[model samples]
Target chain A: MTTQQLTQQIRIKKSFLCIGLDVDLTKIPQHLLELEDPIFEFNKAIIDATHDLCISYKPNTAFYEAYGIKGWQSLQKTINYINEKYPEIFTIADAKRGDIGNTSTMYAKAFFQDLNFDSVTVAPYMGKDSVEPFLAFNDKHTIMLALTSNEGAFDFQTLQTNGTRGEAELSGAKELYKQVLETSKTWKNAQNLMYVVGATKAEYFTEIRKIVPDSFLLVPGVGAQGGSLSEVCKYGMNTNIGLLINSSRGIIYASNGTDFAEKAREEALKMQQEMQQILK
Target chain B: MTTQQLTQQIRIKKSFLCIGLDVDLTKIPQHLLELEDPIFEFNKAIIDATHDLCISYKPNTAFYEAYGIKGWQSLQKTINYINEKYPEIFTIADAKRGDIGNTSTMYAKAFFQDLNFDSVTVAPYMGKDSVEPFLAFNDKHTIMLALTSNEGAFDFQTLQTNGTRGEAELSGAKELYKQVLETSKTWKNAQNLMYVVGATKAEYFTEIRKIVPDSFLLVPGVGAQGGSLSEVCKYGMNTNIGLLINSSRGIIYASNGTDFAEKAREEALKMQQEMQQILK
Candidate 1:
């Protein structure tokens, strides 16, 4: 989906919420386990229950991959379902994948061509060539990791780097995440770039806005990770409302009873209502 | 496999040569396409032909992930074949995956537990918590990317960072990759940690050795990417011959004809002989 289409969906839904379909079979309702593909069944229910409450759905690949071949099949089914049922809604494959140039193309094909996700998250540690392959796909998006929500985010993302200067001249040092953002903009077809900046670091959003004001940011640390939606929206929202606040465990696992899907919708509804108020 | 076990295998084989199984369908012989599982068939042939010449097999996940379900099946079968048939050989899942703490555990489980790889490559951008989970597994190694063998590596990995000195200590600034190596050593299961230092950067290995002298370095770029074997061995090798030098396309795709497996063995044999001489 294009930026204009995503922006329109946010306005229509009155929520830039992206529900993370991080389905864990063990965590779902006990009754679902009896099904052939419990993961897909659970995701189908959640998507059906909460599709209207959010503009996007993100399925973190790790959750599916943990189950092996069965997991990959579930992922394929989930993506196919989303594309067929709600093609208007943006889909993000939260697969933090990156490699050398040629290998990265295969990954791009996997997520964008094969799986048909509108966007896929990518790690920036390998730099330009690693990310450029994903960006090369027209109309598809590459969400590069910036300041993540985890405790480990501070380990290297925030470290001060001398910004292409020699070792001796670290006078105007920028944090590594900022350097990543700045350097990435100069790559080929960088206009297709988006970013993954955790909602937990809402304060960083103001600074991040100065660097790439127009690019969309997929914020993950909102619900279970304890990031406040209001604070994130307050600082991160651009003219086009270029912020996708993601809530994974908080919404999906709201209740593990037979009414699991219904309860998930309730949680999603609360967030959407809050977003409606914020949009006003 | 434990580090000691891996070390012993290197000595026993007199070759730390790791063949990367990055199988692209188009690149493989057309005849294999007629088979039910061409990728698995191709990988089985390569593994059968070249097992004696190499100490380890590193199958990059991207090549498998591209083909969707069938690709994933191939990957599972290939790993199973290696573990059951060549139990002595170390296995590396070149899936450079990393995420937040809890999510990272799932990825660790995906590669280590579910897929049952002896070692898996992880990107270190997310820091300690993201990596420490992978380390939590017994007898499994977490190979973190230190310096990659690509043009993009220069874009971020080599940037001068003021060593955690509150952005003021510009005088003693170190490159980002070195800081990664230093920081990773302090994590919980430091003993289980290895590193990915590209063979293209042979000169950087001397500096890397100072920080991680004992830890194994899984060096790629030796064959297809134009990195030297002797230079990497000379500077990167430790007392335990701590290097798993990888050659993917250079060996596996040596010839796409019917004699592909035999040609691949010949190529691997040449590298193994070179490594054997280096051991002398």
Candidate 2:
């Protein structure tokens, strides 16, 4: 889906929250085990409970994959359910896939064509050929990884580069993540592209926004990762409310009891309420 | 699979060649199109023809992904065929997937768990958290994209990075990709870690090997992209003949006629002969 459609959805729902379906079998309610596909059963309940409150559904492909073929089947079923029932909601295959040109093209087809996800997260490490293939798809969005929240993010992302020709302007000044953001924007206008900046790294958003003021940002690490929603909204929100704050474990596995769906709804509502205040 | 196991297979087969299964629909012989699954049928024939000539089979996931559900199903069938018939042939899901820990875990499951691939390619753009999840799976290797072949690869990958506080040794010296290679090695002792250094970027291998001496290198761009196999072997080969030189189009789509498998085997045999000379 395009950023324009995503913005309209956020406005219509009065929320910027994107619930993540990183459903783990061991973590879900024991009762779901009885279902033929426990993962899908859990996701269907969660999506049904929290559909109206969120603008997007980010399904972490790993969770479904952990169960082997059953996991992939579950992922397909969950995405199909969302598409069939809540067509308005954006679906993201939270699969950070990037490869060589030919391989990237196939990946684009997998997530965009076969599975039919609105967007898929891409890693920009292999440079343009790997990422541009994903962008080649007309309607699908390619979310590039920028500054992430993890501890190891500081390892190489924040490192400063010097003596580079095209990056001489960013030589002694900005961090590598900032360079990636700026350089990536130059790749196929910021329209079909978005940046993934973690909610935990909210403070960096102000700096990130300066580089690409219009591109949407898919912000993860909110609920279960302990990133504050208020802090992220305060610094990261754009004029169009271009932020997709994802809460996976904190919402999907909100309760291991039989009332898991109700608990998920409650968790989603709390985030939506706060997003409503921020949208105002 | 670990480099040791891959090395053993290479020795047993007397070849270090990795034939890339970049099954393009348009390039496949019209005869195979009559089959129930053309891609799988084509792949099975190719594998059957070249199984004795190569130690590994690298199926660029994009080829399968482009076909969508049918593509993925074809991929499953191909891998299953290899597992059942040619179990010793190493398999690689050339899917450069990298993301935050939670999301990456799901991707690892998709390729390593469900698909049963021996190894999967990954992009290190998101740092340790993105790459670590892929490393979490035992018996599964994470091949990180280090130096790629595309024109845009020089965009950010080669940018210089100044070292931080404790990393004073890397102060104002290393490029971003170099730092990624160094830091990624520290992720899990480099046991299950491999790096993708494109054959076109053979010049960088000398320095790359210094940082990751023991790690396996998945070198693409050899055939279709015009990367020099001789130059790549000269610089990239290690004590373990640590290189998987991939020839996708040059090998698989060598001839689009009824003799496609024979032609594929012939093309792979040519590469294997050259690789043998280098190994000696």
Best by TM-score: 1
Evaluate model 2 with DockQ and give the value: 0.59
TM-scores of the models, in the order given: 0.98, 0.94
Q: Give the Å shift of residue B26 in candidate 1.
A: 0.8
Interface RMSD score of each model: 1.3, 2.6
Worst 10 residues of 2 chain B by lDDT: B163-172
lDDT of 2 by residue, A1-280 (tens): 5678889999999988888888887899998899898988988899899999999999877676566556678888989999999999999988777766767777888888789999998877767777888888878888888877787677777777664734355435568788888777766645689888888877888888898888889988887777888888888888888789988888887899999999999999999999899888
Classify candidate 1 by CAPRI docking class: medium
For candidate 1, the TM-score of chain A alone relative to the native chain A: 0.97
Q: Tell me how each candidate scores on DockQ against the true complex.
A: 0.78, 0.59
Q: Judge candidate 2 at residue B137 and give its lDDT.
A: 84
Clash count per candidate: 0, 7
Error of 1 at B122 (Å): 0.3
Docking class of 2: medium
